[model samples]
Target: MKKTVILGTLLLGLALGGNAQTKTPVGSIGKNDPKAKAILDGVSTKLKSLKSLVANFVLKVEGGNSKVTDSQKGTVYVKGQKYKVLMGDREIISDNKTSWTYSKDVNEVQINNVDQSGQSMTPAKLFTNFYDKDYLYRLIGETTEKGKVLQNIELTPVDKSKNIFKAQVDVDKKAQTIVRMKIFEKNGNKMSYEISSIQPNATVADAMFTFDAKKYPGVEVVDLR
Candidate 1:
């Protein structure tokens, strides 16, 4: 269950992830849909203005036969480079320097130092110019869901070696926010995140990003930092 929760979080980032620190020239990237770029840029602009965010979402995992194997509700808090994700029986917290993965079922917490050297996407980067160079995206037309019209965009990774082959993002046209994200892996596993609610510019404290052992009395600490 620990591994499943961690992998779910990683895939969640990929479903709404991007690395903006490194610059990839526009011209160097392959041809993309202009309409999709416009919508995505608008989302990035709106999200960049937020100082902090709290979001609730539902994660649905499907197997090779397209059967819903698992479903979980999760919440994410993001402020700058700090983030905390809670899904089912586990919670992952990071303060940009240190990270703690706590498993409530087993009463264990694994600590590790944040790897600044890697290109892995952080939760905060999901709102930046994440789709600019990493993927070739195109508008997949609009659909009406729950009375709101949503624009769908399909994204294919620029690098072919990635485990994720493609992803689809559904953006609420009027709200200019992501409504849903579906990721397709090479192994035929599908994971989708449906945004339930979002609180932009929420009042968040710095202390929320770090884990306090006191909160979980009997948790065994496995510090690998």
Candidate 2:
């Protein structure tokens, strides 16, 4: 269960970074807010034009009774339906059909089938139109960060039973890219990710999304499929 939760969280973050090209229709939650749709549409348009992307990010987690804060840095590479993510001593590689999660600390790798449900969250759906379904979103306000204008948008899950209560995204107006995102969980945990750098249309080979077991000596392989 712990691994499942961790994988779910990581996949959610990847989904947020995924791509969407079509215009998202206003859902019930955001039907009254045209401004939010407009801003999100702009982001979608920008993401649709990119063939691939590489981003360096900082993740921060806060909350819980101890109020302890933790921070980590990671990198993500996305090309169409494929992605590779590295964080700490762990790496996730997926070719949109199969996924391999390797943990250097444990010297193990887990293989699993890709989830393709209608409600599935994956890297390929991140920036695209994933937001159009599960959550109700609206433009909250705007702010300036490092001289760049940012539009802040808040999203609330239509299903109250979701572990995530709300999410806040800060989109860079000029670049039409997401610079930051904060997710608030029902369990009182708050997680935030800031994109420190981004390279759009990066050249990434397909092999980069597959795990080669021979490269890792004596690593245990767990097949969960």
Candidate 3:
């Protein structure tokens, strides 16, 4: 369940890579700002134009009562509906049919059916148009970070019952892509995922998104499907 929590935190940030947990259907939160919509549309267009994508990111988990902060560097390979996320000792792989969650520390892999119920945000939808129905977004303006102009967009989930109440996405103005994402949860936790590097139209194989037990010696498979 710790892995699920981490994945939800990761994917929810990426989905807001525009943002996951399941909740009631959203009602109209407010009118979507035209400026924000156009910026997000550009990101969607840029993503759809790619054949495959490889991105290196850093996820920084902070807040809570603890004074310490945990940071993990991860790589994500996405091709169509398939994706493989490698973060720390855990790897989350899905082929749009079956999902695999592998934890290296335990040397075990958990398999489950990929739920395409549109209730949760999958990796494939990370760079797509998921914000349209889920949240109301507004452009919060722009700032220059190390010479790169960044556009900031604030998103509020229409479904109040969701764990995450708000999210902020920082876009690279010239590239029209998400550079960083920060989410504020109802539990007083703040998570930030910053894209360190991105490769559009990267060369990636389909095999990367599936769990091959043979690759790991003495591994245990737990199929929950």
Candidate 4:
């Protein structure tokens, strides 16, 4: 008798899920829609004003139904093609020509020139020229999260393999920012990033993107070219 009840409950749940999925309107399902367009415009407007931004954030992640938290304090410098991410006593610098990742723990730095693809959190790429880039966009349906309104958009690279997520990205519309990002890999591993306490236009220096070899005495430089 108990087994029968459980099976009935499961069947009912599936029925409800199917109904909800079919109920969503198709007009808001991709980019160029009124709501999604406004969202992209708002995000662009917010990014254009930011010359350089520094923010201290804590990442809250849920892996395997368990909650894990990590704190990252960093600064981003956006001066044309030059960009840098300084965090946790380490720094990644792209000096408009060559890029290097400096690590104090391993006592070495990695250097590469003209490797400006598939990396995240790039101020110049993510900010100034976001919408202008060649991305296939869709509305991604309604904007709601946990019963609240959130900007939702789906983006796929023109080249299928370039984008890890392939399916879509959920954006928070009212905040004009990315609430969380998800990347689905073929091997059943999904990487997620939730943004918090992002302060834009914070006072940052251009020197932050410069790599001074003399400044660091002993370090290993790994060039991944």
Candidate 1 local lDDT, 88-172, one digit each (tens): 8988888989988999999999998887764456676676776786789888667776677777788888889878888888788
Q: lDDT of each prediction vs. the true structure?
A: 0.77, 0.73, 0.77, 0.50
Q: Itemize residue pairs with steric clashes in candidate 3.
A: 14-17, 15-19, 16-19
lDDT of 4: 0.50
lDDT of 3 by residue, 1-225 (tens): 145545543432332322112122333447888888899999888888888988888877777763327888888888997888999999999999999999999999999998878667766776678899988988876767677777778888888888888888878889888887887778877777777788889999988988899999999999999
Worst 10 residues of 2 by lDDT: 11-20
Model 4 RMSD vs true structure: 11.4
TM-score for predicted model 4 compared with the true structure: 0.67
Candidate 4 local lDDT, 1-225, one digit each (tens): 121111111100000011122123446333344555567677767766766554433222234444333334344455555666655666667766677777778778878675446333344555543443545565655544556455456555554554243434455556666554444334443344444456566666777777788888876667776
Q: Among all windows of ten consecutive residues in candidate 3, which has the lowest summed lDDT?
A: 15-24
Candidate 3 has an lDDT of 0.77
Best by lDDT: 3
Off by over 4 Å in 4: 1-35, 57-80, 87-90, 115-121, 129-134, 143-148, 222-225
Writing each residue's lDDT as its tens digit, candidate 2 over 41-138 gives 88878877889888888777778663538778888888887888888998988898898999999999999998877466555667676677777887
- Whichever of 1 and 2 has more TM-score, that candidate is 2
RMSD of each: 6.6, 6.1, 6.1, 11.4
Off by over 4 Å in 3: 1-29, 65-68
Root-mean-square deviation of Cα positions for candidate 3 versus the true structure, in angstroms: 6.1
